[model samples]
Target: MHKNDTLNPELKHAASTESGFTLVELVVALLVISVLAAGAYSRLANTDTQARLASLQSFKATVLSVAAMAKGMCISDPQCDIDQYQTTSSTTIEGKPILFTGRYPVGLAPHGAGGLDQLMMPGKFTIQPALSDTNRATYFLAGAHDERHCKLEYSITSAQSNPSVLSVTVDSSGC
Candidate 1:
């Protein structure tokens, strides 16, 4: 008691007050931070799938627009034979020869003439001929896991009225 009384009041107060957190408090804080980080990471992970889906939608729109324009050009040109489905026809647009079958642009090259590839602008996707079907052009998202599942398939429809079909398939696991 005498030694304690000899010490200054300010020094005694400073010694009694703790400067840092206890082990239990530190552990709880770490746990909360970890939980928040986990939640944030999960949310961020979903954004990639969303981004790929959006890209696919945009690409599909571009493909539809290009197909329509090519069809219009085919209809306007006297050389394009829209009535003949058995025989392939072609017309030049912007200096590129676009191959067509019954008023619709073919999905792939036909007899060395350009199809969908010539119409579409270069994008961030990888374009390849679909393995399952020769008539389809499959566009895969760059860095995607399952190329077949996560892709946009552009194919020429048999019916002249429909002309073409754009199919989008996105597998979340692939993204």
Candidate 2:
């Protein structure tokens, strides 16, 4: 064989084989990656609404628990009345010492219980006996962060038949 044509068939074939992706392949790969990235971003972006709704639900549960606990205590202990647990101001609920502040406790956990930490949004809480009747009470908790907002209303009535019945409503119009 001539000196210039020294390469074996296997060597020539290996040399001629392409080592990199074609332009179309690279473009398709990039497009796929971008689509995946956009999907991930969309999924992540939708979480805010879900989170706001969850916060509302959690706040509603907290309010309900507070009402239930107060009702149970009022029913059992003559000294601890439902009115004592009422919070008319802006303050965090501190268990035992002050009964309830802006928040309510679920268990024996100290201060700001009922998943208050989960309320990453700004909000308010209030508890008061119905002006019309002393045997009934109302609890209100609301949160708003930007366009996301939630409110929870809880009412407890003491009746001769049921003793205590809790009614709860959750509003997520802003969320």
Candidate 3:
């Protein structure tokens, strides 16, 4: 054999054989991973938003029920009776306090409007005081379900001129 062609057949075969993942295959895998990650992120964000909305709806219901309870207490005239600001709850917000300004806890039997006199998490709620006075009285109830997680507040505006304003707002401070 000529010196220039001295390589063994097995050695030549080995050199010709390729090894490792293809660039195309690696790119495809990366794309799939990215897509899956994006999908997971999107799902998480949507779930968070839904949870917030549900909590808000619950708060709205609580406000309405409380209003009804107050109305019942003053069957003759609810306008003048809902003036008292009562704080009854298991928490506090903005250093104020959480309170239940309703009557009977519930109307008749079902027990309570929300199974509880107040709809608040412990250490998370407040009722703003009314000093000046206006059409009725307003209270700002705020609290957090978790630190750096779910901080929420209710703008409870009770007025004789306009229907009571009950609003709930939430911010992510907890998970």
Candidate 4:
């Protein structure tokens, strides 16, 4: 019955023992949670950026593949004219279905038989003659997804009995 003593032994024991978490423990837990939350937020913010970069990389690869195929065809026959197969739009490329002597190298996603429209970013690709005395053409591939737009430009030059020359450039920006 003293000021510090109670009739119930359990209550007295608990008061002296201190139950649940201490102030320092609570603060540490909160700090750990805040750190994890911040990491997750940063990763989410970078998701768009990662997608944009991947699109650019894929676009470049597709363009290069097409160019290589064209070069191979030209090599087989010195008279092979790539200009005959050149297209100004991806739609035309899609419509053609076949280039050189095989199916189109680029396939649209989900729709295996379709063209670049099935691509990850769903963009346009064009093969146009670049103004040059050499048999050189430029491949322009562009795609837009979310807040990013990626463009890849690749050029191929033909030379009889010689390896075809290739050049590529890429650009990706916010939409």
* Candidate scoring better on TM-score of 3 and 4: 4
Top-scoring candidate (lDDT):
1
Instruction: Rank the models by TM-score, top first.
Output: 1, 2, 4, 3
lDDT of 4 at 14: 77
lDDT of 1 at 111: 56
Winner on lDDT between 1 and 4 is: 1
Q: Which residue pairs show collisions in model 1?
A: none
- Scanning candidate 4 in windows of ten residues, the lowest lDDT window is 101-110
Please, what are the lDDT tens digits per residue for candidate 4 over residues 1-175?
A: 5976645888888778886998999999999999999999999998867866776677678666665653454435433433323321122232443222121222221223323332223355444333211223233444344222345544443344543445666766641
Q: What lDDT does candidate 4 reach at residue 134?
A: 23
> Top TM-score: which candidate number?
1
Error of 4 at 120 (Å): 13
Model 3, residue 124: what's the lDDT?
A: 24
lDDT of each: 0.73, 0.47, 0.43, 0.46
Candidate 1 scores a C-alpha RMSD against the true structure in Å of 3.6
Native-vs-model 3 lDDT?
0.43
Candidate 1 global TM-score: 0.75
Cα lDDT of model 3 by residue, 1-175, tens digit? 7873788888878888968898999999999999999999999977855665565456546655654544454433343334433422212323422233322221111222231223333322333223112222222223334533443444445444554444445545452
